[model samples]
Target: MKPLDPRLLRYARGTRVYLAATVALGVVLAALIVAQATLLAHGITAVFLDGADVRTLTPTLIALATVVAGRAAVAWAQETVAVRSSAAVKSELRGRLLAHLVAVGPARGGDTGAVTTLITRGLDALDAYFARYLPQLVLAALVPAVVLARLLPADLTATMTIALTLPLIPIFMALVGLHTEAANHRQFRLLSRLSHHFLDVVAGLTTLKVFGRAGAQAATIRRISAEQRRLTMRTLRVAFLSSLVLELLATLSVALVAVGIGLRLVSGHLDLTTALLVLILAPEAYLPLRQVGAHYHASAEGLAAAEEAFAILETPVPARGAAPAPAGTIVFDDVVVRYRDRDALHLSATVEPGEIMALTGPSGCGKSTALDVLLGFVTPDHGRVTVGGVDLASVDPAAWRSTIAWVPQRPYLFAGSIRDNIALGRTPMHLPEPPTAFAHCFTGTVPDAPRPDVAAAARLAGAAGFIAGLPDGYDAALGDDGAGLSAGQRQRIALARAFLRDAPIVLLDEPTANLDTETAADVMAAIRRLAHGRTVIIAAHRPELIALADRIVDLAPQPVGAR
Candidate 1:
């Protein structure tokens, strides 16, 4: 990302507020720096040349001390505020990124490991960006201008010299920064790859061991780690070299300004006080810019990661129609999806309201893909899907989805109590209004509204028996993705969400695939109950599930250019 990306301001509201504070503080700080230098130069020149008494200089000393204290306070405030602003910006970015990913769904969200790393370790690098680099960036703009303005009235020679040489530091900084930014990008990309590869290994460790490929995977991880280490060292080397260059340029620039002041002072064209003030303020002019160059490297990785985040944020969400969804038959008219240079799905089908329609096909024939289309997770490359003669794409996704209760082939359960899982974080429905005469006496709000019956939903999904057997019953918490529960139990919990939802349309993907005969029979019975008076679409391979459908539509694999 740029030092002050417009997109950052657009995405993180905290950034605009923080930057305003920083700039205001920076202006105050610049004034204090000039005042401190002025007081010191005047006091020293008076005592050294005019032999002024100590008592006469007491006010000058006090003023100088106050300026110094004010500068310190500003510095402390900048640091304190920067830390808080960093946290707020990171939190805002993280929250927005996660929300977007969830809205888009996993189908187009990109790699899980890369996204995980970006949100965690990757964005954490921005601490350096905010805490150190950003404040200096503001000072770089303010301090140089203020110092030069002060010097213009004191020593025109020194002021002109500073102005002429000051541009050199930034010119060189930009050149070196280009290289540093490229190096940081490479480093961040490698780190992302390493994280993704390691995640893949851990997730499939059991399968790898069964296939006798565990050792191979371990060796691959070591190779990637070594490459990452090499890149890190290379980036650090560039940072150190760049820092040295900036320091040398700044030191030489200040030396040049000092030399010019010394010559003018010796020539009797400048006073001791003016020369001293020029010497003091000359370094201040270069200090902020020099520090900016140094801190830029520290923040480069974070900036690179921010660029990636912006890319995700800027990606257009498939335009959700603002119109509310209409009720009636759902139609897929020659829906076509092109994925990875081939046709993933090409189908046309229709289901009348309240009908149970089964989509039967072999793996890769696009049964799940078709269901995904219905769920509004994937838009077709060609053709259209409609409900009641209104285009589905022209219906608000949220409104349309409110009518759907989907259970995927591998259902994901969060780490939460069974009751919360069944409820899916839904708040209680608003309570009915009381009689008008008693309204003024009532203060209870929606939080006091009656919660839905979680146990009833569980019973409807055939999950009540298993849930009751657990020690904590409804309060029992599961690990990530329902870790402690069996596959059948997890599947039933997902079904429970559907029952609770009571949506008009139900979409099930292989709901009974992995269950034992008895469990499958129970699940099928629940499915029958769920399908009553609902428009049901089932993606299935099993004959038992196919039997439950009023009619079957078989999907055949389409060629790359198939119409």
Candidate 2:
């Protein structure tokens, strides 16, 4: 198991002040309870039983009620602060994780697990750490020490006994905690596997139905579910056992303190009020420790998740070489990109300032990888890629990427208007503020603005007519990844986005692969229109696209070859 990472401290950065405030509130609550217990014990012995005076009992009752209310109020405040902190941390981690995943992409984070796991189960695991485990950890350290100091002068032996037992919580916690990392890792795997299989099953449900094998797939899913059930149950059993052990330890320690205090009272070593206070407040101190111990497993799981999350966040991406002074040509200098356990392919090309160069290759012929290198998505194992005469390796990726626009093989359509998706591709941070039905930004609006240019790009994509027939036109809200539209419709929208950007250099990858003929033709025409006087590199197999290329650099995978 890995040592407890100090990086967990980073999650609490935005919440540091609140964490202190929350813990302080918790201490106030603990103190209130302790004070109330002390007052009540004194009242019972000094006045109620002795019947010396009813006057003194009034102060004790008031003090007890006041402390009880203070404890309740502070407890609520602590909960509110703790939840707010957890929310802030969760928000930051999720956004950062998404951005990193988008930057690294499936081509990089491949075979690890479903992306759903990264966003869903993986992130969900951290909830306990932030929400419960972390707060308890703070309380265990702060509350116990403070509570002990108060009890020390009152009953030295009992306070010391409880104080000494505090170390056992973390010690045994560490022991059992060691084994949990592996168990959590296994659980994470099962969780991801479960999600991956679910996504695959959902995505392929149509195919399965077409082939009449949905039943078989369902059976397979059931089998996976059964395995996941077994894994989950196994984890729970371990968690239950650990909880039992911690409970047992805390129970025995507190019980021993009570017995000793009882004996001391009988022998005249302790007074009645002191003994009652010890009995009442002893469990108060022991409670948080056991709760901390119980939640140790939850924290351990979260820590394991944080490890994986950090791995993705902290990973260094392939360099986007030295930034050219301004937008310059993409130069491939005898670049040889090799995949491990696969044949290597070499590429050499210079996409000049304003001429379209289409790269054609068979599937898995390093076409996408080649584009990835130019886009600085992948760095070549050998040779150099330069833009504007400076090597890409030395360039700032953001600045270099800022100079280009890409229409990937499968462009993503977000859960918003057509305008929002296009804004993502805009250059110079300039969004076209056209007087259309929608302003191309979130806050901007163009009433009844004609999206004909948007429509034109769609027309060229063979998607114009179908969209024209839609009730909302471009104003329709598409589901994430364009769930509402056909796959061809999604591609057309993407091509329209590329057209809308009108970038100096366009790097596209088979933007019309799965579209029907008419749609593909319009999409191709849109590409031609989009490519006029721009450096365009399309990793495409279509004959129509091949005809548009001034020169075709074939990246055909071979035992050995030169293009």
Candidate 3:
């Protein structure tokens, strides 16, 4: 997918080493097969037909047993290594896929269902690839070539016949399974849809319950599950038929070798030992090829997953090189950002540092979009966003965001401890103060009064009372999206997070949206406290919030729908 996802090839690369060993080992293995076959042929000729004594047969029997034991030992080691490699690959690849998903952020929510399917279920299908398909692929390449070389000396006609039929096995596999790739893709798509639907239903379960529609929704879910089952069955049917066809083809080819040997014996052109050897070695030669075809079905799905992971992993990361932050005034010149295909006039404001500028607009206006553009989360299609007198395009987005603290209308709480999630923006764990490290993640440099700063930020946002009231205070656990807290509480916590940031510039988006009137007043006061001696911008619709602004620029409607 990205030429090769290193993780997918990790198992493949290990297998390649094992593969080389297997080839050298398989030569020893094929030699053992030939020796065992030869011993059996010689034993049959001497003991049964020639009426020879145990003296002639006993040594050959020991040699045959020895070869079988050797092959058994090699096979066991090979299989064990293959399984370990598969486990390693699965673990590493799964981690990489998850990391890729995390890196894509909320932008991927639209494709979350499909992406999750690839990571969880699709990647799981790769077990057979590394554990089986890879080995079979290796053996398929090696076994036949060695077997052919050995057989050519003893029974030229029979060996050539078997050689000709080998390609037929794969050809037949493809002919019967021509539509398999397409069907597998469709099945995966359905899997993504199914996962998306399940998540949607679970999230909206409370809503459905309140509407008294849970029963009808359950019926709909059942129907979707039934359809998914039907598609799964269809996919398996194709796999089964393909495997059956390969098996039958192999069996037929081996049967033909027997027939050819019989004719040779009747015509007095071949010996009994040679004929027996040919028959024994024929099926084992096709063994690897047959396994490869069977394992391909599972590998197809893994390949698909690898392809999806690549899309995210290869997505451009914000460049941090060249034309570093310039030493001049930051500027946003006639900047405009619109949601795709929507005509909404976003903010048009101009200000310098040591200023408290408030953004006030009706609901569904572009206040948030304006901040997003300045923060470089979204780019303006029509206007230039400049920082330090350099066009944003000329500088690194990552570096630009480093100089700002943005608290959004909604704050994401990761699935971990509050402290751990906050530490994400920090340099690393080894830093002197953990809370200070978190404070620096939003702003490049740590703020003064690490512990008290966190407490003060929380206090200003009216979160201090609840946080201090908790059993563990600052160490209290927060659920995903701060679930244990109410909507107003979450907003306050976000406000605290931003306040602790202490960047040169603070972009606040609807900071008081979900708060009660009393909490809003406390938050407004907190904002005033934090804004002193720093640049602060706010998006507000409430009168209490609007009153805090020094100047307000009202956006008038344009012919294009919204302005």
Candidate with best lDDT: 1
* Candidate 1 pairs with clashing backbones: none
Candidate 1 vs 2: which has more TM-score: 1
Q: Any runs in candidate 2 off by more than 4 Å, and if so which? A: 1-5, 47-49, 52-54, 99-127, 200-220, 298-301, 317-329, 338-345, 352-358, 394-403, 418-452, 516-522, 560-563
TM-score of each predicted structure versus truth: 0.86, 0.83, 0.81
Q: Report RMSD (Å) for each prediction in the order shown.
A: 6.2, 4.7, 5.2
Give the TM-score (vs. native) of candidate 1: 0.86
**Model 2 Cα lDDT, one tens digit per residue, 1-563:** 13225664564365566567767776777678678878878887887468857675777778788888887787778777767776776667776765565566445654434555765566666666666766777777667777787788888998888888767766776677667667877877777777787777775565688799999988988988898788777777888888888888888888889899988989999988888887888777877767876776776666766777777777776544454435677788989877785645588888887777778877878778887777666767889987778787787766666666677776766667664554444434211112111222334532232455666556655566777677886677777566688766777677766666666778888877877787787677777777888888888888888888877888876454433
Arrange candidates, best lDDT first: 1, 2, 3
* TM-score of candidate 2 against the unseen true structure: 0.83
Positional deviation of residue 219's Cα in model 1 after best superposition, in angstroms: 4.3
Please give the ranking of all candidate structures by TM-score, highest first, separated by commas.
1, 2, 3
lDDT of every predicted structure (CA atoms): 0.85, 0.70, 0.68
lDDT of 1 by residue, 468-545 (tens): 999999889887667789878988988887888788999999999867898888989999999999999999988999
User: Per-residue lDDT for 1-563 in model 3, tens only?
Assistant: 01123544543345456555656666676677767777787888887779988787778888888988998987887788777766766666666655444333333324656766776787788676666676677677777887888789998998899999989887876775556766777777777888888777775675688799889988977888888889878988888888898999999989898898999898999888888878878987888778887887767666666666666666654433355654334456777656568645455566677676777667667777667666655556677766566787777555656666666776655444444433333322111122223234435443233566666667776777877778887777776556577666766666666666666777788888867787777778777877777777788888887787776766544555544
Q: What is the lDDT of candidate 3?
A: 0.68
